[model samples]
Target: MLVTERTLAREIAPAVERSLPGVEVLAVEMLSPSRFCVYVDHPEGVDHALCARVTQLLDDYRASYTIDVSSPGVERPLRKPAHFRAAVGQEVQIRTATPLAGKKRFRGAVVAADERHLRLAAGDEAVDIPYEAIVRGNLIDEGQVQP
Candidate 1:
């Protein structure tokens, strides 16, 4: 997601949490400049269809600002460390904001990942990549989004 949108979500998440108790937001992302995707790891038996409508209602009820919500696309990027861990032994493409070894990109098998950093097995060597350096990372699907 864009910085502005992330800021907005962080500002609104507390309110969302209060209104929708026990609804844990799993992830949020921007699909495009105007589209925002929100994923909630909600409690079972909650009416998702109603929840979606309620979300729309909330956006409409609030006249000052608005947010659009939707599901993750067919392919989703790894947004957390657990996502990285789940991709162990899988090929992945990662991009960083700052250059690492003169570049901001790398692709290799995910060796390990935790809250702190990601370790990628690139050829015979393993490289430790700090989380702050990661711009985005996703499992490499030959026919899917690389990063």
Candidate 2:
């Protein structure tokens, strides 16, 4: 079996942690044979300018390797139910592997959720989608970030 870039990245995380404290390492996926993507984050109240400086440091040493840096947005995105629960009252973008009501994607405000489903409202219409039916979902940021 072939090991994924994410797997390789996971293996390398401990080393990274030793060098960058308090940075949230989200994922490391291979973009090509030599290129890799690194997703990272820090606490909400941390200084973003300093975070960018550290991202640059990571990129600098690995000059030969392509590094894409970014932070999680509004939907931050739900990889699990806990993520969904953490994002109540936020807008989100949901995509399903199979079409729902003829469409495979939906965007709306997340009004509520239970063990089995999530309630989303787009304008005045509220829809209930089974938790199992959601392939991936991200919380969207509706407001501008203050600098």
Least lDDT summed over 10 consecutive residues: which range in candidate 1?
Answer: 65-74
Per-residue lDDT tens digits for candidate 1, residues 20-90, read: 77765445555566655555545453365735853764574346434454433334466568778877888
- Return the clash pairs for model 1, or none: none
Q: Candidate 2, residues 1-147: lDDT per residue as tens digits?
A: 015553555554555556678765554556777676555567653356745655566664375576665565443646446656776788888877578767878788788887777888878888887866775677776674222
Model 2 TM-score (2 dp):
0.53
**Alpha-carbon TM-score of each model against the true structure:** 0.63, 0.53
The residue-level lDDT of candidate 1 at 100 comes to 79
Candidate 1 ranges beyond 4 A from true positions: 12-26, 31-34, 39-54, 57-70, 142-147
State the local distance difference test value for candidate 2: 0.64
lDDT of 1: 0.66
Query: Candidate 1 at residue 9, lDDT?
Result: 54
Please list the C-alpha lDDT of all candidates, in the order they appear.
0.66, 0.64
